[model samples]
Target chain A: MSTLIGVDWGTSSLRAARLDAAGEVLEERSLPRGILTVPAGGFPAVFDEACGDWMREPGALALLCGMAGSRQGWVEAPYAGCPAGFADVAAQLTWIEPGRIALVPGLTCHEHGVPDVMRGEETQVFGALELLGLQSALLVLPGTHSKWVRVIDGGIDRFATFMTGECYGLLRQHSILARMMPAGDGELDAAAFVQGVHHARRSGTLLHAAFSARTLALFERLAPAAVPSYLSGLVIGEELRVQDLRGTLSVAVIGAQALTCRYELALATLGVTVTRVGSQATWRGLRAIASTLQGTS
Target chain B: MSTLIGVDWGTSSLRAARLDAAGEVLEERSLPRGILTVPAGGFPAVFDEACGDWMREPGALALLCGMAGSRQGWVEAPYAGCPAGFADVAAQLTWIEPGRIALVPGLTCHEHGVPDVMRGEETQVFGALELLGLQSALLVLPGTHSKWVRVIDGGIDRFATFMTGECYGLLRQHSILARMMPAGDGELDAAAFVQGVHHARRSGTLLHAAFSARTLALFERLAPAAVPSYLSGLVIGEELRVQDLRGTLSVAVIGAQALTCRYELALATLGVTVTRVGSQATWRGLRAIASTLQGTS
Candidate 1:
């Protein structure tokens, strides 16, 4: 039986799973994976500490995804264009340390004349497809740069990136919206979110209407704590409206549980059907990519 | 001749002028203001210390403006509605210590079901009217909450407030825009600002589109520093676009020296004629209001 290592290295955390040839996770571990924490020469040590036990037996091929493959990661892998299949990503793979280590290439989407880039989430989307038995569907990976990717026949057809998480962080930490909002763990105002979505849809320009948040606060004295949630709804609603996703297939959201819930709620408000997928999809997808590469799937 | 006192208490600084029976500046002094610096009970002591030498005389009527009259300040004054001449604010005045101390009421405007409130800046606008010797025109007070006030025949007819300064602060301090932006004292980016204005005018729904700053950084690889300037242009441009300035006689921006210049440049891009008024306008306006009370100008 062949053994595989599936690695998901995000901005702040890293998770790796050890799986048998059948794609069943034999063991898994998570650790701090942010670039700030891992120095240039420290990745090897960190990786060894996390997955050393599994690799000791030999014949274990490791597949890594996310920021670990970015320019700042263990090895830089160029982005593969959308309409790119698993084989395209496989073809562009870079070997970090010869036959034992392989890194997945991130995906890029050129839509609306704007080039959208993804690193770790692409692997998860691939994993999601494998887990759900989806041949073609819309996959939504909600995060700092939330991505809406189109999957068609085991290939990434197209995708669009929204700065939803980044914007939320900006508004909360820097803008006056921060003053009005309270510090809590992902608490949101559903009613305000709904209203924001409606407003974003009706408003002609999304950016111009953002000042209305301050306007609402100054005029109506709306509670500050609700501003962040309202902003989230506005951005997401505007994305949905601008993208014209009226006839898209059921949306599959992949992220942490809390983020998935928020995306789910926002999409539900728009009367769209969505399914929640976990981060484990990336692991399965990595294994699947390996299986396909070895001609053993 | 009735003696009067004019006080301008802003977020971070407080200036009080003691006037003789002729509304002349008998003596003026300034101190650290802001809620953080002056504890609730410390307002009176700070005020007295700043203006005590001039307050030695008896029966002086005091008029206060700015954050001092905010909910968190010396006393909270209820908002007076637009077309809200001096009479409306005067009517809703809350005398902290009647006769000895009186707070000048901030102006409020309600148009198309939208309400905007202003405190210290209104005094400056009123002062600008006194100084400029004009009654009807667009008064642009450029600051954190940039107020575009319409003065018709010696009365504040209507106005709108834009969070230009606050947004600038947030973008510089907290957003990815901060990465490329210079420190707070950084110079202007003429090209980036112009592009920002053009982009803002063309983009629809600013709230959603505001994230374009970060998107521009990630996708277009625009320098992080240029982001704030771009955001500034976008916001100022949106303000200009939304405002109904088609028939206005002229635009007068009242603020500090540097900000006034930026406002001039922004307005110049739109090919609109504008004038820059100095910060002294607030003092002059306070004097004018005091002159009216004392039957002297």
Candidate 2:
């Protein structure tokens, strides 16, 4: 029986799962895989340390996703465009150090005159689709750069990225709002956020409305720390307004529990129904790509 | 001849003038005065140092304006309502250490359900009025918090404060826009700012539109340093749109030349005529207040 190794090499961490032919996990390990950690020549050493134990499982085909397939990764794989099926990504796979490793190609798409690119999450999107047998659906991946991706016929047709997470980080760390907010306070101010979203949808100029947070502080001495969360609600609310997700069917969210919950809350505030996919969705995506490649090869 | 000392204590700096009974300056000095520098008791020493030489002129009545009259200042002076004629502010003056020192009350206005307040620059507004011999006009005080104040019938009536300068500082120092923007490279991009303003006015969601800066960077790879300037343009542009300043009799900008120029550019983009008031405007304003008080007394 053949064995398989699935790796998700993201900006911050590398997670690997060793599985049997039937996709039953035999072992798993996580290691630091951020851009800073694996400078230029350090990738090989870190990758070896992360997966050295499973090396004895001879002929184990390693499938990698995320930034590991970028120009800066272990192998550079070109992006395949949407309506791109599993076969498209499998065709672009590049081997690193001969037969031991293969890197999954990311997906790219242009929609509504905007270009959307993804590195690792595309695999997860693909996996979610495969797992649910979804042919067409709207996928929302919430994180530092939250993406709203449209999938048609099992291919990523288009997506838009919002700097929601990065904006939160900056406001929490650098803005006056940081002083009033406490760490890990992720609770939703449903009323405030919903109000903000409604206002944003109506007006669409978040730059001006954002000052209201400070104005509330100056005028009423509202806590500055709560401003970030308030801002998150406002932006997310505005996104909901602009996207008009109220009538969309089958919205799938792929991210961590906490982040997904926030997205779910924001969408719920706008009366949108959504399904959540966990971290393992990414691994499953990589697995699906591996299986597709194995079938064709 | 009797003598008077007029002081302007703002967020960053303090300026004190030793003037004769006629309000002619015999000498003047300035020093830093923000809460950051004079935390509590430190105010007394800093104030004394800034005016020690002028204090040698005996029996001069010291009058102060700006944040020095705020709750945290040497003494808190309550706000007088608009049309805050000279008499209103003069009546609310607070004495500190008896007749030797007095703090000028700032102007406060409740108009159209919005409460507005002003500290140091109300003096300048009054000064510009006296200098121009105009009864009603718009006064733009440009700074970290740029104030667009309305003067009607020889009284300061209403105003709105835009955190323009503070926003510029925050974006330049903290946001991704900082990567593209350079310090003191504030060449106004009238087109971009106007576009931003229009976007803001239409959308009314400043936070949502702010990401446009990052989006522009990602899609166009536009100079990162130019982002701050673009943001500035957008904010000012929005202000012009919302305020709808057309065919006003006159526009007087009160602040440093550099800041005034930015406002001028924004106004020019909106096709509004503007004239800049000098640093002496604040002094003249203080003198006007003193004269009005003397006349009433």
Each prediction's RMSD over C-alphas, in Å, is: 4.3, 4.9
Fnat of all models, as shown: 0.23, 0.17
Error of 2 at A256 (Å): 2.3
Provide the lowest-lDDT 10-residue window in model 2 chain A: A199-208
lDDT of 1 by residue, B4-50 (tens): 67888888888877666444576777777665488867888887877
Candidate 2 lands at a TM-score of 0.78
Winning model by lDDT: 1
Clashes (candidate 1): 22
**What is the overall TM-score of model 1 with all chains considered together?**
0.83
lDDT of 2 by residue, B1-297 (tens): 446678989877888887765556778887766655687777778877887666666665677889888876777788777777766776777878565677888876553333556788788888788778888889988776667788889778777666556555665677655765557666665566555555545443344455566556655644655666677765666555557476674589888887777777667655677888887776676666566555233
TM-score of each: 0.83, 0.78
lDDT of 1 at A57: 69
